[model samples]
Target: MAKKVIETSKAVAIAAKLCRPSVIAAYPITPQTHIVERIADFVYDRDMDSEFLDVESEHSALSACLGAQAAGARTFTATASQGLALMHEILFVTSGMRLPVVMAIVNRALSAPINIWGDHSDSIASRDSGWMQFYVESAQEALDRIIMAYRIAENKDILLPAMVCLDGFTLSHVFEPVDIPEQKEVDKFLPSYSPLYRLDPKKPISMGPIGFPNSFMEFKYQQQEAMQKSISLIKKTHEEFSNIFNRSYGNGLIEEFMTKDADYAVMAMGTITATARHVVEELRKKGKKVGLIKVKTFRPFPEEDIIKAASKLKAIAVLDRDISFGQHGALFSDIRSALQNKDIIINNFIVGLGGRDVTSDHIKTAFDKTIKAKQTITEWLF
Candidate 1:
């Protein structure tokens, strides 16, 4: 692998080329538009070889990917926010059919208030869509996740579609130094995808067929089993990746920063966690026992690690970019529920919605309040 400074979107395009997907269907929206644009340039310039289709809509993009994957081919697609919402219906079918299609979703806040900025709302809202999710911190992480995602999703034991989400603009538009793996090395890391079953005329099989009341619940249970089973496989895949490429993130589940010996900790997802890390260091120097835990894999939820981390801390501040109206922040709710029996205060802070800048000061304030907080509740941070 060679290190190169490139824009995040361009890095994704480079990753696509290395993975050698058989088919890539795309319908681009804000932030993610550059991702498909770079792919188009690669296919147009003939630097990469793949069937890149500019489908009319996001739903069509995912639908086309399903067809390709079901036909026994490695497939990929990308979208964000509204575009992802558009394809919401077909997302379940993709996973329900057990197609290992990988997608790059530039996480952006959903609308009603009309936002085109980075937020977890876009992906968090689709948490139950049955797709394994990864929230990356930087462009380099984005590129790495893409390569690793294929291996995890296409594994025989876990045949579920996976999504690699980078914050809209924050991680997408910003440039970062990424170590680009060579084609041969990537090929060695990820073997050619082999499907258990295919849409071959010789062997006709009914897939995603109607399940009777008794049988329908079984299908859902299988999906749940695959997701839960993926926990270890994901860890193993990340370990393998580290062995081959010398890169790994948070044991393939959760990444902890300065949380080993601390009385209070902060938990957050996406790019904001980076800022919180810095704030933790500053608080450490001031004699405060502050730590950070960044949720890297969200769909499987990493419940075990989170519970263990919160067990030692007196309190935790769950900084979320997305809010669940009437309830609490999505991340906060999941974490609170996991730590329900624990005797610790967990404060949910909704910050940086609609592209707001989540600076060090905002994170510092959250930490200050969290370590001193007495009650468990959700609060909006401005």
Candidate 2:
């Protein structure tokens, strides 16, 4: 392993290069631009060998990735808020086709107010794209998750696309020391792409054929079952990753920080969870039993892991960086569903939308309110 101080975007590109995917199709958009640029540099410098396609737009970028993966090539791409929105339609197509294309998303706010800063509005909105989603906490996890994404996506039983989301600017542009594994070790962890199905002349098999009312539900059910089964593979891949690299995040799902015996805890994803960790430490010094839960995997939702985390707490505060119009925060909504019909008190706090900064004090205030607040209450944090 080689340790180097670098921005998360650069780490993403480096990790993708190390994975040695057969093809990479991507277009540049802020925060996410640097990652693709670095990958291009590796190709230019002859450090990485892969088919790199610089498409016209985000939609075409993912479209190319889907095409490449369907042709039996392991593919990768990167995008952010507006770019992701443009590719929304193709996102479902990629997943529905059961192509295991891995993409890196730098989470940013949706435009209209014309903000370029960081938030979870982008990836959180794409949660229903039928792709396995992972929220990273730091540059190291960003690099590690990209590697794990490939393994998880290409799992024989789970052939769905995967997304590795890093907070735009917050984690993507932020510089930190990261220990990157060698290509040899990564090769051991993630073997070459041997897809179960592909489009080729020798193998005359039909894919995405016409699905009438009779076959449509069965196809949808197959996708659902694959996603449900991915939960175990996600955990298994994380364990295998840790066993080989000696690094992991809470069994590849919900990472609990001081939540075992706490009276109240905060649940969040991305870098905000890292900030809440500090707030948890400070609040503990003051004799307040506050904790933090960092969600690593979002899709397969980690419902059971979260229930276990909230089992001992008096209350759990869910901090969401994305707001659902006319309703509560997105992460908060998911947590409530996970702990449904239970007598658990879960408070919802919406903070850090459109790149607004969320300081440690703000997180501490949320914890204080959650410790005493009841369920069914949602508050906006400034």
Candidate 3:
């Protein structure tokens, strides 16, 4: 398989070709348009054996996905921002039913003032909805993670829906060189999805029905247990993918760059980590001890990995693309809770909201501020 430089749209089409979903339900929205448009073209060209459903609204898009998935078909969908908010109700239902539907969220800032640029608000709003979310920093990861998502979601121990998210426009519309595997290779890599349970007329089984409080609590408990079990299954799936693709995804939970012997570390997610890495390298050149921890998987939270990575550091800076009003950065709160016992100083920086550019210089400045604060303060926010 020869590597080729292709637009993000083409990369998604290539992923669709590999996944071979039986049903694709989506409502067009900016930034996310390229994904579904390419998939629709594949369906029209007869290159993919899937039903392209033009849903009336995002709510119906996910609702249709839920129905198709319950019928034991491989299902897929894509949405962003307001579109995702519209499907919020169905999102929870899909997870509770354990349908294992895979969705790609082009992470977009939510609106009251109407903005379509990148942010984590849309996905973070549904963080506790039982769906496993993976944030990708590049187009290659976006395509590759979707494949891994299906494998992890369909695991019998973790029959949960999964969301593979990428920053809108940043990776969605950017052109990059991606090595799209041959169809034969993809088929061998991802076998036919076999659901552990499905709605069959021959053997009628209840799904998504009204459960009383007594049984409902147990069902919720099972969902939590499944999420915990998915942590290991996610690692196993990544290993299998690496074996077949000859490309390792490091640790699927987190990717650390230059953090081995650093006194300060910056934690971030999505494409911002790419910028942070450059800043870390520049600081290292100047004899400044700095490193980065890029979080790839957000749902399971990767608490243990984060603590171990930040423990040796004298100070840590958390850069968040989303804010949690009245407090600090959304990820900052989570990181703080994870490191409460540790003696390391932590700083929170909220940036890149509503598509603000988070340049490498911005990251370097944050690091400088964090290191200075470490000399006297307990905690700092930039």
Could you tell me every candidate's TM-score relative to the true structure? Answer: 0.98, 0.98, 0.97
Q: How far is candidate 1 from the true structure (C-alpha RMSD, Å)?
A: 1.0
lDDT digits (tens) for residues 331-361 of candidate 1:
8999999999999999999999989999998
Stretches > 4 Å off in candidate 2: none
Models sorted by TM-score, best on top: 2, 1, 3
For model 1, the run of ten residues with the poorest summed lDDT: 370-379
Error of 1 at 281 (Å): 1.2
lDDT of 2 by residue, 1-382 (tens): 9999999999999999989988999899998999999999998888889989999999999999988898899888999999999999999999899999999999999998888989988998889989999999999999999999999889889999999999899889999999989989999999999998899989788877788998898988999999999999998999999999999799898898887678888899999988899889988999987888888898979898888888877788888999999988888888899888678889998999988898998898888787767555788898
The 10 consecutive residues of candidate 3 with the worst lDDT sum are: 373-382
After superposition, candidate 3 runs with Cα above 4 Å error:
375-382
Clashes by residue pair, model 1: none
Off by over 4 Å in 1: none
Best of the two (2, 3) by lDDT: 2
Clashing pairs in 2: none
**Model 3 agreement with the true structure over 18-88: per-residue lDDT tens digits:** 89899999999988998998999999999999999998999999999999999899999999999999999
